[model samples]
Target chain A: MGRVVIDVMPKPEILDPQGKAVVGALPRLGFTGFTGVRQGKRFELEVEGEVTDEVLAEARKAAETLLSNPVIEDVVSVRAADGAAGAGA
Target chain B: MGRVVIDVMPKPEILDPQGKAVVGALPRLGFTGFTGVRQGKRFELEVEGEVTDEVLAEARKAAETLLSNPVIEDVVSVRAADGAAGAGA
Candidate 1:
């Protein structure tokens, strides 16, 4: 089996309440010296076979159309999993 | 400034409703050949200054204590951002 990892996050222009809340909580929780906090989502998908370019493209399409809301979020990446590139597990 | 990316996710054994929902939705949404979908969180923390080992350790502590629940979730990584290693942004 192969795997594709997709990372999605709110656009920089968008207001992320969850991220803001985390930023606010950190100082209250005694963790300091951090200026910004942006929270996002990560998805690990296990596919039936090799993760070819076609698979990666389809994954990106899925991310763009279904996994994330384009109005406020951005799909940062849709790539084969792990450090190895252009190959499947 | 420096960025520490902390990735948190539900343990492999834990039931992830959100992930399951996505998995179920994909095939209906015309994206097939996927077997598993695991969802997680990614936090990008921009620190005030250089990211020393001390800063990394503190980030790890924050992730362990606040960002992730040890019982059902795991902090996958707490590290300096990007390709460069052992350095600050």
Candidate 2:
């Protein structure tokens, strides 16, 4: 089996209300020294079967199409599990 | 500045619709071997100033309180940047 991690974040320019709310509440929670906070999502995936380049590419396409919003977010990075090191299939 | 990464996941018992959908789409994406996929969120944070145990603790608390749902989700892990390595403030 292979693993894939997906990170989703709001576009830098867009105002992240949730992030802003979290940042604003930090000091009240007794945290000092930080002026701002941004929040995003991370997804961990375990793919069944042998890891291949084709599998990786397809997974990435699926992520881009349904997992994240290209306009407001970007796929920061994509990596295959250590066991699957072959170049794209 | 210090960096904090927060991993949020749905409770094992709770059905993760998003995760389920992704898992179902894997085979169509040409991946084999695994049968299930679970998805979660990751937040990358840059906190200003020196990193202390208190800062870390406070951050954790904030995540539990406002960032994650204690009922249907859990904070899988929390980590600080290399620069901040002090024990509790």
Candidate 3:
């Protein structure tokens, strides 16, 4: 099976409390250098075979219509998952 | 300012109800071509100046120590947001 990846992030003007919580916790955990944080969503869609253009288009449609709220979030990307989840790392 | 993006996903064996919900909703919305779905998290960390090596290291450290739950979640990627989030799209 192949997979498609979709990323969704809050619009710049939206206030992200979850991100704020993380930003607040970072300093206490002694991790610094970050001025702000925004939390979003990532989706992996499993398909029967290769992630064809048709598949990507469907994924994008799904991203736009079902996965993210257009008013508050933006669909950052809808790309194929190249390999295993940990492959790139 | 530059931003660092961090992606966190649940382990393969874990059950993702949100994803399941989406998969169930897809066909109902007339959007198909996906067999399954897994939903995770995306984080953007804003920093001043540049995304230096030091900053990446800190982001990675924060991702590992604070952003994810070790027993269930995996840090998928910690990358530099090259420009305005909509740039690559």
Every candidate's DockQ is 0.44, 0.30, 0.69
Question: Could you tell me which residue pairs clash in candidate 3?
Answer: none
TM-score of 3: 0.93
Over B1-89, each residue of candidate 1 has an lDDT whose tens digit, in order, gives: 88898878788889999999999999998999889998988888888888889889988988998888889888877888865322210
- Assign candidate 1 its CAPRI class: acceptable
Which ranges in model 2 have alpha carbons more than 4 Å from their true place? A50-53, A80-89, B24-34, B50-54, B81-89
lDDT of candidate 3 at residue B45, scale 0 to 100: 94
Q: Please list the C-alpha lDDT of all candidates, in the order they appear.
A: 0.84, 0.67, 0.88
Q: Would you estimate the TM-scores of all the predictions?
A: 0.89, 0.73, 0.93
Q: Can you rank all candidates by lDDT, best first?
A: 3, 1, 2
Candidate 3, A1-89: lDDT as tens digits: 99999999888888989999999999899987788999999999999988899989989988998999999889989999876774434
Q: Which segments of model 3 are wrong by more than 4 Å? A: A86-89, B86-89
Candidate 2, residues B14-39, lDDT tens digits: the string is 89898888778766765545466667
Q: Which lDDT value does model 1 have at A54?
A: 92
Candidates in descending DockQ order: 3, 1, 2
Model 3's alpha-carbon lDDT is 0.88
| Candidate 2 whole-model C-alpha lDDT, 0 to 1 | 0.67
TM-score of chain A of 3: 0.94
Kindly list the per-residue Cα lDDT of model 2 for residues A1-89, writing each as its tens digit: 77766666777776788778777776777666667666666666676665577766765776677677878776765556455322111
Going through the candidates in order, what is chain B's TM-score? 0.88, 0.85, 0.92
